[model samples]
Target: MKITIWPAGILAIIFFISTSCKQNAPHEDAAEPAFVAHPVAVPKQDVMTLEIGKAAPDFRLPDVNGKFVSLSDFDEAKVLVIIFHCNHCPTAQAYEDRMIDFTNEYKEKGVDLVAIMPNSAMGLLPEECGYTDLNDSFEEMKIRYEYKKYNFPYLYDGDNQSIAIAYGPVATPHAFVFDKERKLQYSGRIDGVEKPGGANAEDLRAAVDALLAGKPVETPVNKVFGCTTKWAWKSEYGKKVEEKWNAQPSTISRLDEDGIMALVKNPTEKLRLINIWATWCAPCVMEYPELVALQRWYGHRNFEFVSLSADNPEHQDRALAFLEKTHSPVQNFIYAGTDKYKLIEAVDPKWDGALPYTLLVEPGGKVVYSSQGPVDLLELKRAIVEHPLMGRYY
Candidate 1:
């Protein structure tokens, strides 16, 4: 929803109108909505191995085309190449173009390259999503496939992830090659290069060449390097990272009506951004990292970003620790009164008591921007840079 700043806000309507002129561009709205993935628990995939001389696992899985594909799908192919991959990993993205090129080049030599997304969508974390344009969700995989126009078969194994566990891929872009008779010939990385530009697919190329020549692969198993498969246990890892972050010293002070009103009034000369969030708000937590990043980006530009937690007084320390974990480098507050309504109305009547509410106030206490829930980061960036108060600094 487009927010209308209160009349008391400086140049309220005019500010929106004028800023809209410079801020609203056709392409800005073209950005895809950010996908927030939830976490779920399941028995973690135990260590498993496909012995070097053992037959490659044969199973049927749905391809991007909605058709079921299996190991036997590649007919008359002298070699089958199964690559455990996903859309989110930087390592996987870095190798996408290279993977496509390799498949095209090798297809002429009877080599079939089939890609599979190995992580459950529920297991994907937003913190792990910043590095890529897409997540590991099935919908995201389809979007990515259409966007990249990948020539090889891209399948989904995230439902049960049985194939992934069977092959035991440590990371995305982990390659598993099978000879004409479907024997596991090579298992490891697609290349020696991680960053991609100047590096060649040396390791994988050698393995494939040797097998095609009817010889043993010189390196049967090369170590793989990439983002760990987003197993269910990764959710616990996120909690641990948050715990480590919160372990640092942090301060969370009580915020009374007078103090809250004072903060909202923007007594200081800097543009003040007041954000109301809660420890239990999933959307808020998902957005915390980006909020911290914004502060780092615009802190020197005379912008002050303050956070107010609606968490109960008894849990103030928890809120403070969360702020610290998020690397919050600004004023932090906790609702002080027993009456939550007083604090809510005092903060912003238009807020309707939302968990994650943000308002950017001009130096004179006039709000220029207000939003609730998770914000489209693109517009958030534009709002900060194009505001009259911040334009000069930009």
Candidate 2:
């Protein structure tokens, strides 16, 4: 007899058979049924956005090299995967390796993977960028693209975000897969795992494999969880964060040689970032704002940024004024001693007594990172986040 098993009917029969077999079987402790039917919860998709089987939207966005890349460019590929990702999101950063591996593995099979940065810098707050060294600006996109050595075309849609709007990506690292006819076959995350070094891009790979074999995707859509996409309209909210930061009172205190030594000792449990700069130092003044931004970024964690000015004790007013102008809300101090050598020795014995000296000290006063010249903010941020105490993700 030819039997046609409907989904519900099959589930009921499996349940009945398993129950009956368990009750009558000689081995009462026999293992449960090899296969059990569990209802799959489908993730909700935006009603107005691209639906399953809908044609992929056309987009002409600039790549890292300033060349415009469009959907039609991948027409020859049997499968196309477009990932809406950004530079700042930790989740996106974690999946970078997987995306690269997926691209390299599938390229030989007529598959193309393209990444589009779809965040507006205006909508991203400094605190939101706490987990990353780079923000979602187009220029930063180029930096990330080159630094990460992405195997796929990395495009920028941050200017207007019109392309992002059409795709309706709810989060960074959201993936959309299209077949040869440009019909969307899958739309969700690259995998079920959120943290780095977990599952490979199994969900995405499954969709691609099915489409390549001229078969429908078994699971076309799944829930995507990551940093929310920074839409341009959210700039108003970003302004509020800036206003609150600026409203905080900027104050500077006098730090003698003893005080500087104590600060360097770092008795507290937090990671202390000590920056020794002077108001007269041009590079110090130029990079002060970024230092303030770094404080704001990692301030919530077990981290503190302390600024020690090497300006003359008599120039306290000038130093304080500069701090106020830069909206520095961190612990600010100016050396109160006439001898600059004492200040230098107190901060670090191995110091060359260079202006704009920066160092990261652990709780027990172990210096993890030290820079003598103008600090590279990106390098500093990486050192901070990658430390044992702080991580890219929880």
Candidate 3:
């Protein structure tokens, strides 16, 4: 035969190559593995503010009484107004009376107004609350609603913020007006003036008036000027604030009797909150952090929180370490003298040489609050926030 006996190894290699080629070849009717699709990641789209003529976004939110209220509840009104307001914004506080008056005036005319607190408390840092006595929490919303005796509905959208994301308010005091059909006709500042006592609700009034008259609004949009809307995503900034505050140098100075007296005198125009604490005192160590928190809550306003350590001058390093551990960035001092009575007298005459004494001193040494034991933080907060110089509103 022309084909001699082939070597077994060569024949085996040729057979393997032919079988591998057949196995690798595609099948014509194998169903192509059922066209499996792996899920792909898509970026989230940003929610934009409502545009003029758009249908009002539906929402069911809780009012002060824990009763659920919805947009459809006001269907009988010929005109509707929604104010994205909060407890903490000075601009929103400035317009509270005006909003109340507007609600009263328009309710008889078949127009209804509702104030929606569209802020997430998680996004509100204590430092961002300098302008008011309360933060934008549902509980605080209830407090404000009751305090103001608001005629209109005051709903809270802070839990999930889905309603806020839908409305997309850029700032507190932002206003939206809707016609009888529940179509948005205007969105923006409540009026031209930022401060109170001008042409009250001029812009909002015009939009409501136009809609009630069955006419198109002349200015459908205006630039909003107020506290930036506290979106839930903004909570990330709280970490940065904490980091920045912790990075500050935690130094303690030696304050003699005179220096301590000077601190009590409060030369500056700020409301001074002074705490006298000893590193060895259990109550002092426990309550120190809350005092620091108070500093953050009202620091941006005309306020200062001074920490005067009852620790001896020689133990300043120990006191400084404690302050650093607590991330206290306020002015800190350690008593330079060994006399505890002088320290008590210098900080506050009313102090009975207690381990943890606190004082809220106004400028020129007027004592607004004094506590001997672990303070009731809420009471202390109220004292600080309700003071004349630190009032909630402008």
Candidate 4:
């Protein structure tokens, strides 16, 4: 008897409700960025700290311009700092303001700041970490580098990672401070602070201030923590990449008369143990078994060993064959030239040029022992018995 709501009215009401619900719903948040994960497990290593009073190691590396720069170059400064840093580390990023302020405060005080980036793994090639890359394309690094207006150079560790390994630096922003006489004075965390927004102790700043005031730096070392250096060149290509970047003008890949003479002339005082032989020479061949053993015995010592092969163009093929045959543990290089005798004489002029000549050149280029024939291990061992650089195990 009462008029019921019509189906059309009900439909209209449902449609209105659906439309209202669609309009009021919240949107989903955008996806977050992803980072590349390490391929293998990295063992958590205890943070390493250098000791005070240890002689700060010296090293040379390329700046942004691909020029050689060394720690010794900053000798005139009253205090010197070598800081290992990277662009991506948040801990390192936190120090931007402090680094800038420190630079400004100490620049006029004759202190030098040298920041090293050991992130060679970030680049496709070993040489790409040059100054231009750090200055131009690395937005984060460039921004930090510019903001700091660092008085000192931000150096790149090219193919030869000699500096990073030498310092045993485990983190970004790892620091070592040296006094005027080049003795290590302080090393450790920038200031007892680890993460951002920590309480302000400023240990590093305090140490530097003390040194600048002509007072002894009481804090000699610190345990630095941050991202580890990711150096990529691992396999054969990696080796080539590193060698290409660190290639010196004086470096000779093939040992020739000219190269041997140059090394002999350059380091007059160091012990020079030159091993001359060839794959085809039989006695030069027969003695190789013993020579291979002797080479292994003394491989790790301080004396320089030049394993010269007179095989010329045939060197690579024959050397590989010899390596395959004996599974020889000795590392050897082939002498490439048409005239082997002239090359030998150029290295040492005293007598007839001969293969298997083993000579120990003193610091002054004096020949300690010159053996014209194949080397006897016992005889050679006796010659190097008490010698300073030849006593260590490989």
Compose the digit string of candidate 4's lDDT tens values, residues 1-394.
Answer: 8997679989999999999998887656644333222222223334334567777778776664446688789988988877887654546666656666777777888888788876544333322221111211223344546544655677766344556666667777788888888777887678766654573427777777889898986766667766556544333455675565335221114666767776566464446666677776766777766554433334434445556666775557766577446545344666667786687676687757656566766665667777887776545655663465543111
Q: Write the per-residue lDDT of candidate 3 for residues 1-394, one digit (tens) a residue.
A: 5879999999999999999999999987775232221222222337689998899999998887778799889999999899999998888998999999998888999999999988776678888887766777777777788888999999888776778789889899899999988999999998988667776899989999888888899999999988887776766678899888778877788989999899999999999998989889999999989888877888888889898888888888999889889888779989899999888778877777877889898899999899998998867887888788887666
Worst 10 residues of 4 by lDDT: 128-137
Candidate 2 similarity to native, TM-score: 0.86
* lDDT (0 to 1) per candidate: 0.78, 0.86, 0.85, 0.61
Model 1 C-alpha lDDT per residue in residues 335-383, reported as the tens digit of each score? 8876889987888877887778888887767888888888776566557
Candidate 3, residue 251: the lDDT equals 76
State TM-scores per candidate.
0.56, 0.86, 0.81, 0.41
TM-score: the better of candidates 1 and 2: 2
Candidate 3 residue pairs in clash (backbone atoms < 3 Å):
none
- What are the RMSDs of all candidates, in order? 19.5, 23.5, 13.6, 20.3
Regions of candidate 1 where Cα sits further than 4 Å from its true position: 1-41, 238-394
Tens digit of lDDT per residue, candidate 2, span 1-394?
A: 9997679988999999999987887985676443221212222333245789899999987888778788889999989999998888889998999999998999999999999998766678888877888888877888999989998999887766778878889788999999999999999989999887789999999999999999989999988999987776777787888889889998999988888889999999999999989888999999888887788888988899999999888899999999988888889998898898888799999889977899999998999999999888788988998898888775
* lDDT score, candidate 3, position 134: 76
Task: Write down the TM-score for model 1.
Answer: 0.56
In model 4, where do residues sit more than 4 Å from their true spots? 1-50, 122-149, 194-201, 231-394
